[model samples]
Target chain A: MELTGAQILIKLLKEEGVKTIFGYPGGVVIDIYDELMKSDIRHILVRHEQGAVHAADGYARASGGVGVCLVTSGPGATNTVTGIASAYMDSIPLVVFTGQVPVHLIGNDAFQEVDIVGITRPCTKHNFLVKRTEDLAKTVKEAFHIARSGRPGPVLVDIPKNVSVTKIKYKAPGPVKMRSYNPTCNPNKRQLQKVLELIKAAERPVIFAGGGVILSKAPEELTKLAKRTQIPVTTTLMGLGAFPGTDPLWLGMIGMHGTYRANMSTAHCDLFLSVGVRFDDRVTGKTDTFASQAKIVHIDIDPTSIRKNIPVTVPVVGDCKCTLEELNRMLEGVDLGDLDKKRKPWLDQIQAWKDTKPLAYEQKDIIKPQYVVEKLYELTEGKAIITTEVGQNQMWAAQYYHFDKPNHFITSGGLGVMGFGLPAAIGAQLACPDHIVVDVAGDGSIQMNIQEMATAVQCNLPVKVVILNNGYLGMVRQWQQLFYDKRYACTCMEHAPDFVKLAEAYGASGFRATKPEEVESVLKKGLSTPGPVIMDFVVEKEECVYPMVPAGAPITEMLLV
Target chain B: MLDADKHVLSILVENQPGVLSRISGLFSGRGFNIESLCVAVTTDPTVSRVTLVTKADQMIIEQIKKQLNKLINVIKVHELTGSPFVEREMVLIKVHAKPEHRAEILRTVDIFRCKVVDVGAEHYTIEVTGTEEKLDAILSLLKPIGIKEIARTGVIALFREPK
Candidate 1:
């Protein structure tokens, strides 16, 4: 069909099965917005470009589909950088469309012009700048393909202002075929055999899983492998819900603020089977001492992630689901009559470690942040889809809440960006409207994008925000206390807005809990509210998250409670 | 300690937009040092061959190769090793060729098997293609006479397998 580039974009988006887009219109994108106005697809008008990206990210995480967003050029494009990097670090699939200056004015630094492609190259999985209207369909298709394929990440397509209005003969392209883009799905039999041997021979085996398992939708397969072999599973922050958190074999998240048993088991285990994990610095602590006694096995879709950080005994480059299925198939043929008997002593040791100081915090007259997370967790019964802003509040939530399903616990794991939780919770609620969605936020991080409460109010998302109001940048203050000899410089936020009034101003219900006694009633009331609700609990400002493994120190050497 | 070593890598990639940027950006973004680089289209119109010379320890180079292989347009990456491979760098040297120094410069050019592609009244643009060592030797010989201008295309290499 002969259509303008804007119409072609709509057609391509429909072809890709994109039903909704988070976007904000601007000068260069007016034509596209005009076409969108007449199209069947829904458009969410966010207050800023960052919110658009984060909303898309939240939607992607919740729905397991590529989230789409559109924004104009220059500042509009630059504003999405943090959100794009957050998605990139966490491996979220998103297709972002940005308007460009007319093709001729691209390099001339025209008004509202930016080299977004060059700027985003280091962060994006791949990006495109469409010059001709005819190439729009193909570029759109390729962008979707690249964004969702293999180890999925964000992809950007920049459309020139003229191209959006120019008419072109458009044809739907065939399936994308890139010779070098094929990701490994099936695990090598030899490597799997080696892993099997290691699992069979080792006395203590720990299965360290990560976000890849969730991204691959292989939680069932991973659980199968862990249960059949009777190996305890520890998850990264991103991998929180990949394994059922309530299972007896489930050790809580591993790394800096990891559970005692999880970190100890990892340190002492003879075999570590890491599935779909990149072993980021936060997870490994110190590379040289990480899993020193273990023969590590890493399975991931990306080959570069195999040995990028810590050395591994066996590296299998393949999709997590496919690889786990292959491992289970091979295990079906093996005799494991006495596997449990062999792992009994190891299980006992891990249980002992779990008994020793397992995520402890004292409850005083003041409302504790950890207590708030625990109460929320109990209220939701581990069923709410929870997102979190970074720092102390994030850690408290991670420690207190237990997730039983994939995509239930979403956070800015890699980037640790503040202002993520509220928008993310809004996006998640948008994706899963039937379920309860909550954003556990720190006082400092919540204020970063408190404006998004208005978004929740506008969309009627009913995203409950539980702010641990510690009146300081809790994480940085904790670091200052531990590392810098209590030099609290610029970490305190003494002059902050009254959050309750602010939430009411945004047309949402607001509540506050001043003492430990008021925490429960406030939580119950805020959660039961039909629309967006913000509940701020005044927490102990001096309290710190425990089991701190200093930077570059091994996880074994932790400053515990 | 793992000592650092220089290596040449030949990569075949799709002759498409953004592939070069992807490759170069991968290097620069990751802080991998690229000593030299050369790129040209292959016999196949749709494929471009990129030759890059980089210096890194064995681990970093392995990581670089793995990362380069991950790019969507990269078809293959072959790291050249040992003395069996042939390498070349092309240099265009414009030496001061006064009437008195003309004979000596010509003799030096002849010794290097270089062709004088262009000539001015006082300068000769001589084209030389050989190993880096040979180019360095010729450049040093012309240095005494004051080389007016020089342009060098970074290394391009190929493996000399038994045929």
Candidate 2:
């Protein structure tokens, strides 16, 4: 049957099981949106193209599916760059479709024309410019396949206006097979044996899990290996939920702004099994000193990430889940005697460090941000899908919100993009309708995407925004206070819109808590009354996130609260 | 001179728009230096071969190969620096030929097995092809005769198949 390129795209999306797409319409994408209206796929109209991409990222993280977004060319496409970069940094699977000018007018820079594929080349896993109607189906198929494949990242497909409008004989594309792209999914048996031997011989071993564990859906296997081996687990910020926070073997996030016990344990461990983690500078305070005493074993799907940052003794290149399964299976055959009994001394040492300097804060009158996050976690039973804006609020949520399951905590960990939380909460709410999705935001970061509140209200997504109103960009302020000798330097954001009125203006419920005692009541009211509500807690203006490792310092050395 | 840091990689890629940009972007984005690059369509019309030369340590060379492999357009990346290979580069050097030095220049060109591809009233444009060292040797010999202009196609390499 003859079909337009736009119809073919919609049909391919349906075949790929893409039920919803977040997008905004413009002149170039009108044909695509027109075809979308005739199909069953739900199109969410976001206020800005940036909101669409962030919401799609949130949806992908919460649902564990490839998030898809659509936007017109030029400014609309450029607006999604920040969101695309964030997803790229975190290795989030996303397929972003941008409308372009006609193929003949492409280089002419006609109306709404921009080289989106060129602009997004470095940030995308792959990209295609569909210049012909016949290439649409295969390009779409490849885009989805590449986006959700090994070491997943954002992919862009730019469809010109004429291509979208051109009609061609439609035949559904078969399974995508790229001769150039093949990801190793299975681990080598010898590598697994080597890892097993190390685990058996080492007196102190720590499992350092990262976002790859969650992306590969191997948290169960990771937990099993950790429990079976009795090794303590420390996660990167992105790996917060890969291991249960309540487990006795759990060490809080390890890095700059890491827990005292976690940092000290990393510094002291003998065998470090780093799973699905690329050693980012933030995670390793000083690369020379990081895991200096440990014989590190690195497991990741990407080969380039293995020895890019820190040298490893054993490098296992494969999917995280597959590698962990192989390692776990290898463990069952090995005659490793009584791992728990052997690791007692190491565990005791970690516990001693934990007991010595636990993560702590003080609150008397003004609302402390940490207390607010703790209360939210308590009220939601640690089950709320918490997305966070950047800065101190994000760090606080990562510290206080104990995620017991994978994909429960979403944040821009790698890019640290502010204004990610609110739109992400909207996407999460839409993806998991029954779950309570909340954006733990700060007063400074929330205003970056405050306009997205309208989309949440319009779509009837009951996303809660708990703004830690510190009246400043709290993270930078804390840094300036610590290192810059209190020369504030535009960090203070004193004059801001009253969040309650702002929420009411957007046709959503708004609540505020000024005193410590009023925090719980405000939260309870905002969460229960919700068809999208904003809860602003007037927090301490100068409170710093504790246990911060100064720049270039070793992870073991931290400025405690 | 061949050094441990200098590497030559022959990359097979899909012949499509912006593939070169993607490859070059990867290099610049990671701060990896591309000393010289040559690309053209191979025997297979759909595939293009990119011959790239980079200067990096062993670890970085491995990373550069892995990162190049990660690109969707790239089919295969083979390092020719460590293998028994044949490398060729062609240079067009236009040297000022005075009446007194004409015979001497002709003798030098004959020694280098270079052809006089183009000749003007005052200059001779010689075309030479060989290994990098051969090209450099001929250029040094001709530099004394006051070379007018020169253009070079960077190194392209192929590994010798074992008999």
Candidate 3:
């Protein structure tokens, strides 16, 4: 049957089980928007194109499905770039749709015409520009597949306005063959045997987990293997919820801003079983000096990631869940005799370090960031789905908050992108409606995508946004203070919008807290509110993210205040 | 580091505007200077194949592969190094020739297995197909008398067996 490109798009999304989309309509995408009006899929009208993309990102991360977004060309498409890059860096599955100029006037520089595919190429996993009406269905299907497949990332489909209006026979192709896109979900037997042997032979073995464990939902398997092997486990910032933070074997995050004990244990361990972790530069301060004493065994789903950052003694490329299962099975009868005795020295040293240089916040007249995070954790009882914006606030949330369940904490760890929390909070709330969704955002990051409050009000999604109003881009300002001698170029925002007024303008409840005593009350009020609420807490501007290991420094050389 | 042996690369990219810019940007950003870059549309209108030549060692080639794999529009990248590959280059040489030298030019073209595609009053455009070095030799032979203009189809190499 003949169908318009717009109809084909809607049908394709419906076939992919997409129930909702975040978008804004404009002249360029009027045909698609009109067709969408007749469809069953729900579309949330975002106040800005940036909000649409971030909301879609949040939806993808929370639901573990392809998040969809639609926008017009030019500024609409350009505005989504930051969000797209954020998702791309974190490997979130997102299918982004942007209206394009009519085919006839594509090269004429017509109104609202921009080269979106060109601009988004570096930031997306893949992109397509629909030239023919017949390719619409196939392109849309391929976009979803590529976005959700191996090492998931955002994909963009730029459909010309005229093509959307053109009618053509829509026949969705059965899966297209991509030879280069082979993703292995099973571990190689030889590699698994080698890793198992190394684990058994080593005296002190530690399991280093990352977000991949949570992405693959292998937390149960990871915990079981850790318990059976009696090995200590350390996680990266992204791997927060993969293992219980309160467990005895758990060493809370290890990195520049990680706990001193976690960093010390990771550095002193003999056998490092890195599972589902990328060993990002932030995690491995100096590549040459990172885990200098450990023999690394890296396991991940993507083959290319193996040994790409750090040299792996045994590289097993497969799904984390499957690999852990195989490893657990292989270690069933092996003898790990008195390995705990060998690890006692390392553990004792780490404990001593922790006792002396624990994660501490200075007692002051004003409320500390850690105190605010800890209070939020206590008030919510560690049951809330917490999302965080980038920089100091994100580190504080990760460092201070204790996560008890998997997929409970979402943050942009790899890309360190700001403006992720608010929209992601929206997506998380939509996914788990009964759960309390709290977005811990900073003043700088929240303002990046603050316009999403309109989406919150429109959908009546009660996402409690707690803005740590530090009056500056806390992370950049800290870097400037430490490295650039406090040049403070554009990091300081002396004149900024009143966040409380901004929230009220979006038809939502707003509150501000200047004192430590007011934080819990404001947060409770915001969370208990029927609709969306924003709480702006006046935080100290000059506060820095401590326990920072300068770039290329040894993890043991972390600077603590 | 430049290697003595040259490596041929075939990259499939989307047929979109500024895609070339993205490709070049990647090559330049990573300091992998392309020796030769040629782009042409494939049978599929939406796809284009770019053939590039670079004098890179094995390590640099691996780095290039990783960097190219990261590009969004780049569908596939293959390196035809030490492989049974069919390498070809097309060179159109316009040689200045009078009526007296026309027969000699024609004879020379016949001996080199080249074709005379266009013949003007004072110039003859001889199309030569061979390796880049072979084409260079042919151009050198034609340059002594008088050469007007030259156009070349940069090296496009394909492996004899599937990778």
Q: Across residues B1-163, which tens digit of lDDT does each residue of candidate 3 receive?
A: 5363577889988787677887887777567778888899999998899998987766567667766765656788888777788989998898999988888888889879999999788989899999988898888877776889998888888789776
TM-score, cand. 3 vs. native = 0.88
Question: Residue B78 in model 3: shift from native, Å?
Answer: 4.7
lDDT of each: 0.91, 0.94, 0.85
What tens-digit string does per-residue lDDT give for candidate 3 at A1-561? 888989988988999999889999988899999999999998988888877887887777677788999999989899899889988877888999999999888878899899898888778888889988988888888888889866788999999998899988767778756544556789999999989888777776778998888878889999999888878788988889888988877777899898888888888888999998888899998888788888999998875566666887888888999999998998889888775685677666766877888888874778677778888899899999999999999999998899867878888877776778888888777777888989999988998788888889989999999888889988989989999999999988888898889889999999998888887888788778888888898987788887899888989898889
Off by over 4 Å in 2: B1-4
Looking at the true structure's interface, with contacts defined as alpha carbon pairs within 8 Å between chains A and B, what fraction does model 1 recover?
0.67
Winning candidate number (lDDT): 2
Q: After superposition, how far is residue B109 of candidate 2 from its true place, in Å?
A: 0.7
* Poorest 10 consecutive residues by lDDT, candidate 1 chain A: A168-177
Best by DockQ: 2
Give me the candidate number with maximum TM-score. Answer: 2
Report, for candidate 2, the interface RMSD: 0.6
Q: Residues A180-250, candidate 2: write the lDDT tens digits.
A: 99988898888878888899888989999999999999999999999888999999999999999999999
**What is the lDDT for A444 in model 3?**
88
Q: Which parts of model 1 are misplaced by more than 4 Å?
A: B97-102, B119-122
